[model samples]
Target chain A: MSANVKQKRTLLEWVRGYTGQKYITTVLFLLIPIVLLTLFTLIPAVNMVIFSFQERDQLGVNPKWIGLDNYVTLFTDPTYLSTFKNCIYYFFGSFIQLALALLIATILCSKIKFGNLFKGILFFPYMMNGVAVSLIFRRFFQKGDGITNSEGTLNTILALFGLDPVKWLSTPGLVNVCLVFASIWRYIGFDIIMFIGAIQSISPDVYEAADLDGANGWQRFWYIVFPSIRSIVALQLVLAIKGAASVFEIPYIITGGRNDTSTFVIKTIDTAFVYKKVGLGSAMAIVLLLIILIITGIQKLCFRERK
Target chain B: MAENKHYFDLKDYTFKETPKSVRILFQVLKYAFLVVCCLVVIIPLIIVLFGSLKTHDEYIQSNVFALPAVPQFSNYVTAFNQGNVLRGLFNTMIILVISCFGTIITGTMTAFVVQRFNMMFTKVVKAIFLIVALLPSISMQVTVFQIVNKLGLYDNMAAPIIMYIGTDIIAIQIFIQFLDNISVSLDESAILDGCSYPRVYWSIILPMLRPAIATVLVIKFVGIYNDFYTAQLYMPSPKNAVVSTALYTFVGPYGAKWEIIFAGIIICIIPTLVIFLALQKSIYSNLVSGSVKE
Candidate 1:
């Protein structure tokens, strides 16, 4: 009995030693990511919050604390707040993109020939550099100089259809629509890929049962597919909302945020870099961050209650 | 049923017993939608290809879709030289290589440690990553810019490289999920054989992580390569131009020569398109697994 007890004690000691060694390895391995994360993400995030409350006079100089002044300007300034209205165009565009992506993804996940080829072609845009896409679409929507008699790709197609050419990028009201349209084209591929993945993950047995039960196509989709992929849809909804609010590249590259097509992010970047209003730009960024956080929080609560 | 075990194949039977007319109509509509989407995607790309070969006179005289009378291969050469695309490609390659290596190492290590060890510290690290991911990284760029400047990393390639390595939440998630799939007994067996935990990780864990690494590497490469904002903001110098920024050089306030810009766009697109086509299968599945596993 004593011998057995002694062996047990030794085994217990060995297990303790194993755990101690494991903990040491964990700390050692975690060192680099922790250090880098702190230096880059944590420190910068804290400094951003501080910068939002301070005023900077010059580049490379220290900023002075000006409590609530930057926040006050952001709320009161018409020029600053007006850019957020542009997000509405993109917000609505994102929903349209989501719906189309869902439809296409669902179809692709079904009995379609050339499904792989179609997916490849559709997803190719997401792989292309954003700047390249912006440039391509810029030419796509070019307004013809009547003197030169040259028309943009879209207008030429319109002319072919016996419809008069429309000023795609020049008209103030229509320009955001064009910009949002481009945004959808670039991003809808991502949504399709994501939705297709979600749709495909549904087990075939489930579908087989639905088929045996004489479930029609629409019935199967509405009852089974919709519920199955609802989580991804919810997650993507939040992502789409954030993306719309913070849209920067398409409009920034195509229009350079000119002609009232500036989104919140472009305006913030310009305010900080172009206009040298660092404090105000930081405040704008913080506001945008808060808005995103609130949206995410609401989504979580809504999802939880539904579940 | 044996041959058609894939989910898509299983879906075909559901349509089989339906009335033939409705089935045919649905099939046609599906093809129609797909074909239209494909055309919409391909047309803009085709126009760029056509425009790149056209002469200045031809571009101005013809509509956007008209094919070039003669292919001007020299336009690519001109864009190559004038747009500084070669230099940009070189710089982007440098950033891609270092950042990919760093992200894989740091991401895998964090995943291995956190998932294998059940501890309060591990929980905290996981929570930290989740919170950071939720916080919009773009909105905080203003302060990151200041930090980069203060650290004297402005206009330095290391600036973007470090940021890319550090800010990879998706990579960590991918790694963690992969580690979870790996049996813990493998590590324990190695440990039982008098191997240290680090040894177990190196010999057993790292080898098993090949698929995950490939997924992470491909995803990281594409993301870092296509990134224009970080490359533009941090390293704005002509000498420091990456592929995306190099293309931006052609943009002017007045009308740019469209042919050359089109050439530049083509040059930037070919590398990614080739990669995508070659790894199309794995890329799709890996992206799906990584994302949905989250």
Candidate 2:
């Protein structure tokens, strides 16, 4: 109790030390955002959960208590269910992408030639903002453009050896796949950069010790490099899961959830903004939030400190 | 068998004079893989450039990945004149500058109190702001729109800018981490020298916050300026539209003016994109330093 009073007095002394208009600075500093966020962000966020518990009538004015019926409907809703499957597709496939990203990071961080130049180019897609990536990819995906035709970039070149011309973003299954691939391409370089830093953090003495023990490259990597960067890989895994959940921009831009390719985010936006079904949208949002919470919990369990 | 390779890489142990066949194969594979990755990333950008130069029909029928036949530069002029992309550019600039300024002032001030001052209220405030990063805005979609309408800030430049500053909690959280490392000595010195708390921040602390300041400005400028969602959702009117929205409409019913849309995209990307490319080094360097410090 005496200590509390003593700390308070010193704080007051500091305050009193300021010459003119005491406490005015504190007031000014905290004013704008405090006021704005209180009303704009906090209130609305609270209201969103409340709205989800109610049902609105046709005229868009009347809202009645629904008692979790909307969540029940969302679970049974075919479109929503389909979206979960698609997101699962995106999530698993992206792990394969992380391996590619790790490979790139390894090479870039290695004593190989022109590694900096390679790193810069690999990171190029990531630096350009999301909007450009969307628009440019939209052009790239246009069917008539034939750029995506059998002799087009993917068709005539990379996958040219056999498989059919993947409609890219045109078909429902392929659309989700294509969007996931694009998302991977766009953002995986960031993981590469992060991984390079993690790899660099491993002490040279450890590797030297491994070399002195006559450990081969694979053995050294398994014993040293992999273990050292587990924290980073854990971080990347969390990021990847979050990416799967909140991947709104790509789906929104490319298909706008067209031909049943929409994710939960797209459905929520449509319900709220377009259909004037704010209550339904709120319910969907809550469902998504719950799912994410579960996922986050599981991720924490999976990536917990294993030392 | 071992007396061959001469080169020592960044890891810095010397090798023999000549490389082995297996080493040569791995090097070849590494460069080839990197080249392919670079091309895939760069192709979208290349296509955007080429697509911008073609006629609308040409963009449709011909190869999007192909070089333009005539290299029509008129698409840009047409896009600027027809789309009111110029107006969109001007409107976005206003929001970008004002919102960034508002964000900095509010964020720095809020963060300062939240981090430095020991009030009970500030603790609650910090907790709320910390969680703000987790709460996705898309979850609050309907309420935000309704609230904006209630506030009478709907569809105006004020709407997007307000949202920008209002949701700017996480960046400030990051800023506070940096501010934590910064010594409070100058603030104390200024206070003792008869400066008020605000005055001390203005004169003493804000100057010392140059690294943090640069990091914030460059990062925020690129992010908010390049944002599509907030602008797409809130400010839908062409008169009040940002470049992203303008480009969206340009591809719509009255005009799928592909050439113009393409041109507008190029124009829209220029200011922030050029700044991005030029300051790429500095921005990455600052981010590296900040990330390292954190």
Candidate 3:
């Protein structure tokens, strides 16, 4: 007992001595996570940029220095060009997503009963796993056997309306649309929650003043609500663009990058693992990163100018 | 006869409100839109749930809207055994606990030091994190995979746990914001009372950071649970597979068998759904505050 007490005293004394050097202790605390972050995140990111320039195998072995050839091929390749076009579809989908979310959020923000229930139900899908969502939507969009066969929920609904079953996944042109719809279904709730928060943050005095001015609902929303949520809207726009560019899970799982739904990230993964062209894949990823950076920069500038 | 007195109407005296008919119309429209949105969100999920209860022949024979003649409760049993869900759940729980605690400790510690100290190096570190947050992480996966392999972390459960704990910039940001709000005088008082810096962190600061810690814990837990891509890439072996990757077996082995796949998805989602429903208020509010405060 005496030895244990003495040992504890000495440990306390040592800790006291250590704490006397406050700055050093502070540095020590910060050092650990920072080093881990550098090792796992920062260095790997820098290595990605470096790998973009070096020709390497999928396993990252036998590197040969190849300059801008990967970038050149990436830009000129027909398949990759189509992927960029598909990104535009997702970009448009993001706009629709934002608009729809904004509408729902606005309505929910108004005086209504069961608002919480509505919000909860709407936001449920955002909690779902990407793989699970893909599976659910895959089953939902399955084509029926005959005009009366109920192969999928969608086909059942279509048959009820006396319409032919839509080839949601199989058709080249329709596949991207279906994937975009699924993305919207999964992600729109997040935007709604964000918009609701932003809308709620705006002081009610502004709305009351607008009401005193005899403003209609549409006019009030246009002049008051829209301006209040502009920053969030801008942020979501950038995020949407980023999401559209790097979309992977839905198309990758549903169609395995088939039927014109291949995204840039999907293509990058294919190039790296499937084709064993790590160098080219790294270049493609870098290009996508640069594109995102440029787009985000432009958005910042636009928002800044407006301010 | 005394003149009859006319009472002043409060409604007329006040500012003109929306017409009652228009208000009713708006209410009707609002409910209609909300119902449609709810259906859009839930109809697919409901179909999946019902589909899971049906057998293969029944699924093909009946419309998706049709209720199963006899619910196949055994599908869940088969899915649990064949899909390796039990093992996956165990592995995922282990990873989630380790990574969640790791994230919280590191995030709070870093935030505490950065907020308490006014050093050039700390500022640089903060700037590095900010820049990293702006960059797209998925784009760097190729090199990350290489780094993981070089470190011999590939196919190890530790790889995802390490990556998750180290790569969470949002948690650090949230913690720093919370720490900034906490007055520095508390730390000074603890120090003056002969408490060591680490002791001050443990006794004074950490207890005060309960809300922030809860927010970060929920967000990180859900994000890690739903993540399939990282787990699939780093921990591909069956023994090391987490929940998301383990669920992938259904897709691969039970291809085109929507009934079993639905069952597997339900099994995967049940825990998260229950948690979300139970903590809906805290989770939703935290998510809102975390995003909106930025």
Candidate 4:
């Protein structure tokens, strides 16, 4: 009887050891990722807010505590304010992109021939390197001498039509237009893909019913498809708007933000890296973050209410 | 089928309610629009291809759409030699391999531990990950720059690798979703057979996660390969240039030679084009799944 009791105690200890080991395993597995996140993402996020408050010449140089000045400058300064206004061009452009994507997605889902081929060709550009695409467009929109303008592809086409070679890059009025076009070309494919998925998910019974009821294609699309994909549309719009506010690579590479074409992000990067105004740059970043956060918060509220 | 036969099975009906002329017009319009869109997308690529093969004077004097008199394949050689294309590709490959593997391991381990354990700490961790996903990564990059510099990892490949591995929320989400489908009985039975938790995870749980891993691998590979901002910012030196940044050598404030730049662009585009063609189907499905999950 004593031996049985001892065996029970030993078994209890073994089970206890097993539980303890599992706990250790959990901690061990989580330890590196958590530490990395804290070091990289979490700390930087908090420090960004902190840096927005302090005035620093460089990133970590001699710093003076100047609360709200950087933010004040960010808000009141005309140079910075103009960049935020520049997003309007992209904001408007995104609506056009979404509309086009929706139209094409509807067509593609309607048993169209060569649908896969069309999609593959259209989406190929999205997979290319951003810098390379920017380079391609840079050559594509180059200004050419009117008499023998043979280099710029767009200009060459214009020349073919007996039209004058317009300065696509140098003109301030047209530069933003050109930038918006590039943004659309790179992103419309993504919007198309998303819309196609949403459209395909709609049940066929609804379409069948619409057909049997003598409804035309337009009526079917208007009453059924559009309303069904409203959530996806809303989500894509939110993302596109968010993307508009942070338009960076295309302008940064194509025009290098010259000729009043700087977006908010390019301005932020220039302020920090080029001008060495780390504090002001941090404040600009915070403002950008606030804009994005507000947008996402609104989206969450809209989604919750619908539910 | 018999019940629906009397109800007029509209699903199999070959006829549409729309008028014939309207249907024809719609079909014509759809084809016209698709053909035009496809041309608009393909024409630029064609221009690049043609321009890449032309001599310098041919590129300048001839129309952008004109065929080169001689297909100057040497332009590619010039681009490869002068642009440091090989080194850029090699550096990008290194970064891609290390970061992708690191992400998979860390992401899977975190998912396994969180899903297996019903602890408060795990719940908080999950919440933090979700919130971080909502946070805009670009806005916080200002401070990230400073931190990396402070860590003395400036201009090093390790900087981007670590950031890529750490900042991935999508992989964790994918893994967690995948883990939910996996039966806990596998782990339990192994445990009952004297298998330790880590052993069960390594031997059983890891093998079951192959599909999720492939999805993450493709997404992460394409993202890391095509990334310009991080590589351009972190790995700025010519020796450390990535495929994206390597093309930057040909173009800048000063005017560039269009032919060589075109050659470099083509050189950079080939790898991704090949990968896309090879994994086209999986990529489309994976992207849709990832976005829907998000």
Candidate 5:
């Protein structure tokens, strides 16, 4: 009891004498997140880099050092090559997503009645779970038993127009489009919300000034609003590229990456878990990471050059 | 004499100069566009709601967009039992509460130190965080899963909670931005009054941080609640299933029954929808400001 009391008193004196209360508290405050970040993100990132270079069995046991072999296979394999190609479709899809969002954001930001109501309704989908969205859209896009017996909502609509029901999820050509459409449905609102936020940040006085100059709606958007939110657009572009390349959950749940809908991330998950090619999966992940980094870098360069 | 008697009104002059027909046409077009977009957004959700209310036979027989003749509320009862939705909700709530609190505490504390201190270590810490923020976390999942497994946290609630709290860069950014707006005089004055650092934080700063706290809490709550990928990966067991995973598995046995699946989806989404409706204004404003400043 005496030793414990003495140690406590000495510790108190040490805190008071050398570091001061402010410094000690700062240390205490920063400790948790710093530690957690290191353990979760930083260390894992390094481990991932190392794992990519080493070969491991399906169960991720008995690692053998094989330098660049995984990466070689990733580049040469036709299946993996197609997965990379699929990312291009998503990249294009993101463009549509951004355009649609921008259109909605600009229109909503204008002097319109029930703008808040419209915003609320449109942004609601952004909060839904990915799994729920997949199910809903799957039902919406499901193929019917026959042309006359259309089951999916889209096919029913097509039938209402007297057109033959299209194979929404079955055809190889249309399946990726269907999945991308689902993605657009699920995430367009999020982009709209972000774009709306960016648009709202522009001062109204600028719009009024442009209005006085007889700059029509399109001119005003091009000159004042678009330029002001260019940084956000660039940021969103980077995010779009990243999101497209890493597109998972939707395709994974909706099609299980079948019908040529497999993306880079889905393929990686399949490799690691299903095929038990841990090293190869890690390599694919690294390749995807590098692709994202390079794209973001290129985007940065383009933005800088335009400036 | 009548023209002289009535002063020319600005509204009347504008309406007379520009054809009201054109203006009305523009108004109609604008509303038409908005309504079309609104329909596009709402129709799918409506279909799901209507589909959920239909009996299995009705769902299979009727058109996809057709309304139910008699709404079958029993589907929800069946969904609740078969989907294990109550258990899912209970488990998800445990994750949501713990992770939200954990994120707020860690994010605020770290932001406080990083924003307040001028020490070299703090700068290094900030730089490290920024770098990690830019890195694609999806790429590191292989190692992350291994790490979780090695830590013996797999198949436990703690796995997702830890991941959620540890990986949140947005909350940290928001807190730091909030701290920048708060004057340091409050801290200095409290210190002068013999308040310890921790005491100053609790008494002077925390209450002042109410708005930021609310924003972070709401964002994190929605994020953790809706997350399926992490939950699916870490918690593989059915007994420990959260809402998304539970719904995924529930679909297996009831694969042919779209009504039951729709019911489960509705149940899964209702809580978020209700909370969103109740807090629309604050949530919208907070989200706007959060994205803008970032």
Candidate 6:
């Protein structure tokens, strides 16, 4: 072979040593996923941050790069302001939902038979299509039809005890109340599973020692179990809140953004596609992203301190 | 005799004939609680079944929990009448099949690179993984919507297929944990033997990744099967809808046809249920096995 041929072969051989075919394979596998993430996730995120400050004209294509004009509009807009207020209202459910799930998980974990079976059953709702569940609720919540007339599950059971029916779906604030129920139904199992796994990771020996010292059931729980799984609790709380705030499918499909259920997510979609104000919608999403980031950063700090 | 009887005091006694009735009472309570909990889980499913039998007018007259006065199975036929259920099913299957394979392959490769390779920019790569994990799904939604819309893939299944593979950090994270259990000595031996890293991975490491592979496959399959959000956002056109979306269309914005909605819901549930039942053991045990460890 010529010297040039030898040199090329040697270079190929060296590349082979450093990375082998794995490097090329690695690059190939990472290519599509990375490109998609960069274009869709990273670039869009940057555009959103930029768009939130800009104003768009009638055509809705070009952003006129106004100085926080969109943000100014956001504060003045009733739909925007009300939904933002409702966002805080929505946050209350997250706390209760997580707490409720955590409580059930705790009870079930404390020597319940077929804990795995129970956990599986509880998580069944999570597997459901959110839209499907929402439809079920819509009928169940129909004014004077399901709840008041005892046609829905809750009202039927209540009526059996000789109580009046409730117009569950038609009630103003009850929409959120039903959302909590739906959320709690779907997520309680997940919270329990996560907590159970974390709680189970605590050695039985610690509980046994506490028992030997005559620590009561509640005492053992507080002193021994609580401190042990603090980190896991922090993780669960953060994830649960994150899940709740991002909720769109249930409200969108079930209620169709009616009855005060138009959350940040619902309105964001509307502002973009429905209202044809893509720039404004993108700006709103950017604000949401910032809120999520701040919350996550706080959670990390909390978790770190917990450790 | 009295002293001897006192020795057999209450502290040392098992359930006696005197407490036998109480024992039975407690046993009944146990079963009752168990049944109630199970009822809570299955009630929604039962309602869906009974609701589907109601005629559109009956659905309006009766509450959701009311028994169907007439058991009409034609709601299912009605559900089919709205659109081509079979076509949507086919489209969903195609998207699922492609994405399932893509997720498995790409997920495995990413995990392998992050765990096995010690590149100069390992820190940067690892940081990216954390960012993906820590970020909320909605945080990424805006960007995805704008770009996918701009690229003119809004009505296509390709968007979700790509998203599944791209955002699948959990499977990779799980695989990394599994890989940690594997001794690195085998890879070292392969290197000494002049086997390339790709060759080593494919021939040696990939075989060991079977358990992780099974976990990722089963979990992702279930996720895509029941997925509504991505399908709704990206594939809004009716013809391209998945089962989840097809069911939603039946219950359109104006008024829901309960019978058809129920039929669609039941139809959607059966596939996932059968798959889950067959692999319940693996799914249950996979979650239990060394996840979230320090």
- List interface RMSDs for the candidates, in order: 3.0, 5.4, 7.4, 5.0, 7.0, 7.9
Q: What lDDT tens digits, residue by residue, belong to model 2 across residues B168-197? A: 765687678878888888677776677767
Writing each residue's lDDT as its tens digit, candidate 5 over A1-307 gives 9999999999888777424666898788887787789889988888778889999864467899999999889888788967878888888999998998987787776667798899888888888888899998888888777332337888888888999888888898689888888888888877888887777667766756765776665566678778888888888888888888888889999999988888889889888878878888889888877887798779769978988
lDDT of 2 by residue, A160-230 (tens): 46665556767767777777777887787667777777776677777768767876656666678788888
Instruction: Give residue B161's error in model 4 in angstroms.
Output: 1.0
TM-score of 1: 0.93
Q: Could you estimate the TM-score for every candidate?
A: 0.93, 0.86, 0.91, 0.92, 0.91, 0.87
lDDT per residue (tens digit) for residues B142-194 in model 5: 77888888889989999999989998988888888899999999988887787
Q: After superposition, how far is residue B27 of candidate 5 from its true place, in Å?
A: 1.8
Residue B218 Cα positional deviation in candidate 3, in Å, after optimal superposition: 2.1
True contacts kept of each: 0.69, 0.44, 0.53, 0.57, 0.51, 0.33
| Model 5, runs deviating above 4 Å | A1-14, A58-60, A146-150, A211-214, A299-307, B1-19
lDDT of each: 0.85, 0.71, 0.82, 0.84, 0.82, 0.69
Model 1, span B31-123: residue lDDT tens:
988999999999999999999999878888887888999898877998898788989999999999999999988898899898898999998
Best-to-worst order by lDDT is 1, 4, 3, 5, 2, 6
Model 2's number of clashes is 7
Runs in model 3 deviating more than 4 A are: A1-20, A146-150, A302-307, B1-22
Error of 3 at B184 (Å): 1.8
Model 5 CA RMSD to the hidden true structure, in angstroms: 5.1
Q: Which residue runs does candidate 2 get wrong by more than 4 Å?
A: A1-25, A57-60, A145-166, A201-220, A295-307, B1-19, B56-61, B185-195, B254-257, B287-294
Candidate 6's error at A219, in angstroms?
2.8
Q: Candidate 2 — what's its lDDT? A: 0.71
Best by TM-score: 1
Tens-digit lDDT string for candidate 4 (B199-224): 98899999999988888997798789
Q: State which candidate, 4 or 6, has the greater DockQ.
A: 4
Model no. 2, DockQ: 0.38
